[model samples]
Target: MADSQRTSEPINIVHQDEIWKAHVKLEKDSAEVWPRKWGFLTDIYKEYKMESVKMKETLKVGLPSHEVVPSLTTLQKHNHVGPSPPVPQTTQALIGWRSGHAHLQLEKYSTVHHGRRSFLKELGWPFDACY
Candidate 1:
C-alpha cells in the first residue's frame, strides 16, 4: 500500500478520559427532577451515546502500548473485563481494571450489538430502543 492513498483520518491519540472529559461539560442539566428515579434510564442512554462516540474513536486509533503500565495492553482485547488477578496492590492496576470494565460495558450495550444472537443473555435489552 502506498502512502499517497492513505486517508487523512483524525486519529484519537489521547486517552479515553481526555475524550470523554472534553465534551462532558457541554451537557445541559437534567430537568427530570420529579420522581428522581424517573427517567434516569433515559439519562443513562444519553451518556451511553456520548461514550459510544469516544469508544469508537479509541477503537479507530487502536489502543497504544504504555510503558508506565505495561499490562494495560491486556485491556485492548475485544472481550476484556473480568476479575483482576489476586494481589492487586497498586492503584494503577485497579484503575486499569476499571477502565477495561467500562469499555466492555459500553460494547455490551452498544447499538452494534443491538440485535444479533448473543451469549450474554443476561444483558438482553429491548430490541426497539438502544444506544
Candidate 2:
C-alpha cells in the first residue's frame, strides 16, 4: 500500500444504536479481516458476520484527532450514543479521548504513552488528552 492517505469527510455519526452495535460486534479476528489502516474506524464494519459466540477480547486503540476529546456531556451531545442507564460521574470526565474514542480503560491507553509513538505521530490531537 502507498504511504499517502486521505481524511475523507468527517463522519457525523447519527443512528447511535446501530453504529454501537457494529462496534461491539467487531471480533478479535477483525484486525486480520479489517486490516489496520490510517482511518481505524473504517477497518471495522466491512463484511460483518453474526457471531453466536460471545467475545471476551478488548480491542483498544489510541484516540484520533487533530482536535481534542469532547467532554462527557459534550461526547453525549456529539456522539448521541447515550448509555442505557446513567453512567457514573466518576467515569464521566475520563470519557474523553482515550476511553471514549479508543474504547479502552484509562490505564491501558494514553496519548503520552502510546500516541507519541512514531506510527501515531501523524494523527495529531490537542494537548488536552496528554498525560
Candidate 3:
C-alpha cells in the first residue's frame, strides 16, 4: 500500500447515490444501536414538573409570597419574550450598516409599489390581478 495521499475524481450521479445510500445506512444503524435522546418539549415538561413538585413542598412550610418563584408567564414578560420591541422610525435610528442598506432598499421598494399613480395602477390593477 502506498503511503502517499491520492485525490479522487469528481463525483457523478452514481457516486452521489452511493454516498447518500451510505449516509442513510449509517443513520439507520445508529438509530438501531443507540437510544434516542429526550425531545426538547419533553425535557421542558420534565423540568417544569420537577420544579412544581419542589415548589409544592416549599409552599407547605408557608414561605412568604415575595420569596416564591415567579410563574413562566411572569418570567417571559420580564424577559421581553411576550411583546416585541417597538420598530425604529428610520434606518438611521437603528444601530447597524446592514440595517441602513436593508431599510433603504425596503423604502425604495415601498415607494415603487405604493406611490401615487404607482406601477400597480399603471398596469390596471383590478384587470391585471390574475397575472
Candidate whose TM-score is highest: 3
Off by over 4 Å in 1: 1-37, 61-131
Off by over 4 Å in 2: 1-14, 28-131
Q: Model 3: which ten-residue window has the lowest total lDDT?
A: 97-106
Write the number of the candidate with greater lDDT, choosing between 1 and 2: 1
Write the residue-wise lDDT of candidate 1 on 1-131 in tens digits: 76547678654557756877666644423443543757778898999999999989888865466644545565576445466445457887766564355444545555473466754455775555454
Tens-place lDDT per residue, model 3, 1-131, is 34234446543788889999999999998877564553666778999999999989888776589999998988887764233346678877666533455433435445555446656667767755666
Ranking by lDDT: 3, 1, 2
State the lDDT of candidate 2 residue by residue for 1-131, as single tens digits. Answer: 33235456554457767788788678645765664544555434442322212221343445568566667987676665434434547865645534553444446445554444542355576555566
C-alpha lDDT values of all predictions: 0.62, 0.52, 0.68
Cα error, candidate 1, residue 124 (Å)? 49
RMSD for each model, in Å, please?
Answer: 27.4, 26.7, 23.7
Q: What TM-score does prediction 1 earn? A: 0.19
lDDT of 2 at 99: 51
